[model samples]
Target: MWVCPGEADPELVRAGVALIADERGSVLVDAGQSPSHAREIQAALLAAGLPAPRWLVYTHHHWDHVWGACAWPDVEIVGHASGADLLRAEADRPWSVRYLREEVLRNRRLGPSFRARALAVDSWEELRILPPTRVFTDEVELPTGVLLRHVGGRHAPDSTVVVVPDSEVMLLGDSWYPPPAHLRTPADEPDLALVGRLLDDTIGWYVSSHSAPMTLDDARRAIAG
Candidate 1:
């Protein structure tokens, strides 16, 4: 009963678009904002017949995406090979350094946003950086009754997404958001080109980690966009 649907994190609803599931021992994609926020996601999953999660999948190292991952059982978690570095970098840069500026104190315009992140953990070092149980340079597959493809160059250098071919479903990280055509910048813009080629080479539907779901044709069109 692995549920993969669009969800929101109460703390930062605007930035949250989660993917949670429970096929065998709870495998949640993106453990979410913090432990409290993850509990909220857990409640939702429970209400929908899914249990608390024991494992997780990090789409990238965005603080809003994978912070509370530690709260989950340190089962066989997975992500891109570069994911660990990205997570480690989370604690490297100051909370204020996210927005490049003359100096940390010189930046005053980012007050509200600053406060939100000021509370963030300055170093992911104590957090273990959550290594993937199986890291791959190019691709990896999940044998849980589906073929999961770990893709790079969608959101971050360590960005990744999965696809269940038989179900015609794709768990696109931040590579794409459908039905909306404004914010489509990716770590690898050329990835857009590859998306079209992927769909043409195969037949399936696509679902983003954040926005609405799309079909194979939709993926091709969006890739072309």
Candidate 2:
């Protein structure tokens, strides 16, 4: 798991990134918020004696979970088919550097420290928006026990979950958590059954995109209500 020390602020949701590996190579669950965040992840991998990630599996199309993908030009990225479409659509929109700067300034939830670190971009050109190299509608298995499953919900139409069967861990990217009002659309709605299935005994650890890791029981209780 990748932890950014001194970066947590209650107002903001700090997503946790996970690394899955076997003899073949490493696979990153999320790319992080910026190129700097990707570098931090790279440093963590090096320190752990692991090689650079060969695969990057995104849980969704959120900027926090995908913007860092530009840093790994060679990594084979995988996500839901719709995620690729969304990325393409977003790239076509007016996401200029000035617009992003204004967004950073307007977000009060981002503490000064987080704003400083996440938006340390030198130029708008530095921002990289990449679509998935590989896309799947339901599930796909990699060399390791890694599995990517699409479980769209209110969070986003392209929401996905990464399951590492060997590790008994499931990475839920906003699948259960509600998206912010501005980000939500009229078509979005919760999928309680998906939450229950994800929390089932098959997954021992639940890694949420915006909260601390939760045990199976914790997830069960959280969804019970």
Candidate 3:
């Protein structure tokens, strides 16, 4: 597995992207925030002698997670059905500094902080939104023995988790995060019970979207706390 850690800042927001490979090509996790970011990941994979990815899977439909889909045109994109719908809706909307600034002012959900991150790109006009080409309901298991399961959360209703039972690792992809303060969207607490059920004795390493990977016990305590 190869991972490109995410970065969070007032001026930029980038979620992590990962690759799980086997003798039969590879499967990518998130797509990052822009074409440049995606290229960086690709270059790293090339340098590491990893197989080129055949599929890109989204953990959710958030901008920071799926905006980089434009860069991986050759790879098939997969995501939750609701996430695809959200991305399709976003694809229909205009993306520009002026538009984003206006939305930041008018749309409470798109706050000023988000605007800053969105405008951090070198060229806003070059930004292109691509929804997932393939979507699934419930869960799907990749040939790599990776499991993608929907575990809706306040952060994103279409949130998904990737489980590698053999490796005993799971990518949480912000599924355990609280709803963004910008959105102020009313939501229930995170479903720690469901998360708990998934984190059986087999799983040891847990990766959250923004933070470094943590031990299974640490993950459980963090989620419960």
Candidate 4:
């Protein structure tokens, strides 16, 4: 099942979070934007009668994708090797400490309840960086049939993709998106060749973090035009 804020709300864009489950356990892909977001995810899991995730796989080290990971400190987090380094670097930055507070303030401008619900942090000190427990250079397979691959893209050096062959699902974390003028940049665009190759595979569902999930044919057309 996928857990997301639905549409692009002011507090957060359409960040996608997925839960892949099997008899062995469940894996959560991409922790959401804040602690409250994590709580939302937890509630969804409980409502669905699914077990708490045993593994957390990140697509990249972007703030939105990794910040809420601390909410699941006991889960075995996995991601690209470079992501681990980036997480450590980001945590060391002074601005990182202020991010949650700043976000809460920004949301407050939207509305008080929005601010309270979006961020549950009493102090920035509550925010802590939780690096991946297992970092892989290329690919690794979990017993549940989820494959994590380090598919670097223009978005981030540590961008990864989660593939579930049996389900014909491919979760592309901000790796590929319809080109927009404001976001267009030669240095930070997705790798078309890599995307084309993945699209050519057996994937039926193409899920992205900031956009609605698309069918394989729809993805191909989006890339073509």
Candidate 5:
């Protein structure tokens, strides 16, 4: 329950769960979609029932990973300085009209498949959730002893990539938004090519906002082939 499907995005919304370790309390890599979806993320934390979250981080300002942040219990929210602005906007509007149309169709026809999509778009305007108590430009450390670095100018204005070498895992929000069919599709299409370059240089063992952890070799091959 602690690391199943995050609420950040819906369509192929596979979740990347908590990277639990004995040395440190659980450091939730990212909060999911709306407050409701965040509750879903919390379900996993609840399920773990030990080493409760000491803090939470955001991959970026994307509505899916942020709007749901209000559900967190006033934990320290970490991110690039620009991330809060993005989240503020998210709680102000529904997704683009095109996105909503897709959501309606996916919900009505796609059945259970729409769960992720709904999580990403549902209650967006009403929730207005994201509020990062802490902000940083480049990097920050978690009480659990994980180091999160803000990989700049790759995915979005305030894109963040969280790394915890002790866990030997890195949480990449939508930078590598997994395609519905398991393709290396960039969630931020405009920065797709650029982001790929950053991933090449910085990441090793990567996890998507919605998929399982991917090894460096797998990530490179997914990009090249």
Candidate 6:
């Protein structure tokens, strides 16, 4: 398993991209924030002598996690059913800078912060919003024994986690975080119980999109406190 670290810039949202590979092929955790960011992941893998990804798995439908689908045209994409539905809604929308800036102004769900994150790209010319090619509900195990689970939380309804058993690493994405203030929702809380159930002896490390990888014990502390 290899991880291409994401940017820490609050205005520029690039979530950590992970690669778990075996003899079968590689499975990528998130597509990334933009074409440039996706290509950066590709370059990082190449530099590390890693195999090209065969499957791209989304942790959720947020722009930072799914916008880089266009960069991996040949790879099969897997996303949660509900998250795919949200992406499908914007599949046809133009992803130009003007459109994004306008969306920031008009869409109640989007705000100035959204504008900063959405537009932090090298180039929007190659931008294309492609929905997932394969959608699953609940949990699915890949041929390589990597597990993906739909554990919705306050951060995003379609939040998913990827578990690589051999590596004993779990990709938490943003599932552990609370909802953004702009979202104006108070209904959901972090599903620590469900998260705890997955953190048995098998898993030793947990990686969240925005933070460095944590030991299993550290993860538990973070969630508890």
Which digits, one per residue and each the tens of the lDDT, describe model 4 over residues 1-225? 555533466354436789988787889998876665678888888898888889999998876777778877579999899989989987886543355357546654424423433344434555676778898999999878899988786667888899988788999887764333334556555455667778846789988887778898987887786
Candidate 3 similarity to native, TM-score: 0.90
| Candidate 1 colliding pairs, count | 1
Clashing pairs in 6: none
Q: Is candidate 1 or candidate 4 better by lDDT?
A: 4
Using TM-score as the yardstick, the better of models 2 and 4 is 2
User: Lowest lDDT 10-mer window, candidate 3?
Assistant: 183-192
Question: On residues 1-225, what C-alpha lDDT tens digit does candidate 1 reach at each position?
Answer: 344454444223223434434353545667665555556666777687666655566766665567667656655677777877666666565433454333335655534334444344444343433556666666665544434455555446666666555455656666542211222434324456546545634546666655667777776677667
Model 6, runs deviating above 4 Å: 107-109, 184-194
Question: What tens-digit string does per-residue lDDT give for candidate 3 at 87-205?
Answer: 98988988777777787778766675566556556676667888888889999998778899998877899999998776788998988777765755566565577667668678888
**In model 4, how large is the Cα lDDT of residue 26?**
88
- Cα lDDT, model 1, residue 72: 68
How many clashes in each structure? 1, 0, 0, 0, 12, 0
TM-score of every prediction relative to native: 0.68, 0.83, 0.90, 0.81, 0.68, 0.89
The ten-residue window of minimal lDDT in model 4 covers 109-118
Q: Give, for candidate 1, the lowest lDDT window spanning 10 residues.
A: 177-186
CA lDDT of each candidate?
Answer: 0.55, 0.74, 0.81, 0.74, 0.61, 0.83
| Candidate 6 per-residue lDDT over residues 1-225, each given as its tens digit | 988777788667678999998898899999988887788888888889999888999999988888887898689898899988799887778766778778877875777556755565667777777788888999998887889999897788899999998888999998877776467467756556766766867789988898888898987896687
Model 5 bad stretches (over 4 Å):
5-23, 91-126, 176-204
On TM-score, the stronger of 3 and 5 is 3
lDDT of 5 by residue, 1-225 (tens): 134544344464544545444554566666665566667667755675655566777777755566566777756777788887776665565554466567657565443444555545555454556657789887887776677777655446777777766656676666543223322244534344544665644546766665656787887666675
For model 5 the local lDDT of residue 202 reads 51
Which portions of model 2 miss their true places by more than 4 Å? 1-7, 10-14, 101-122, 184-193
Top-lDDT structure, candidate number: 6
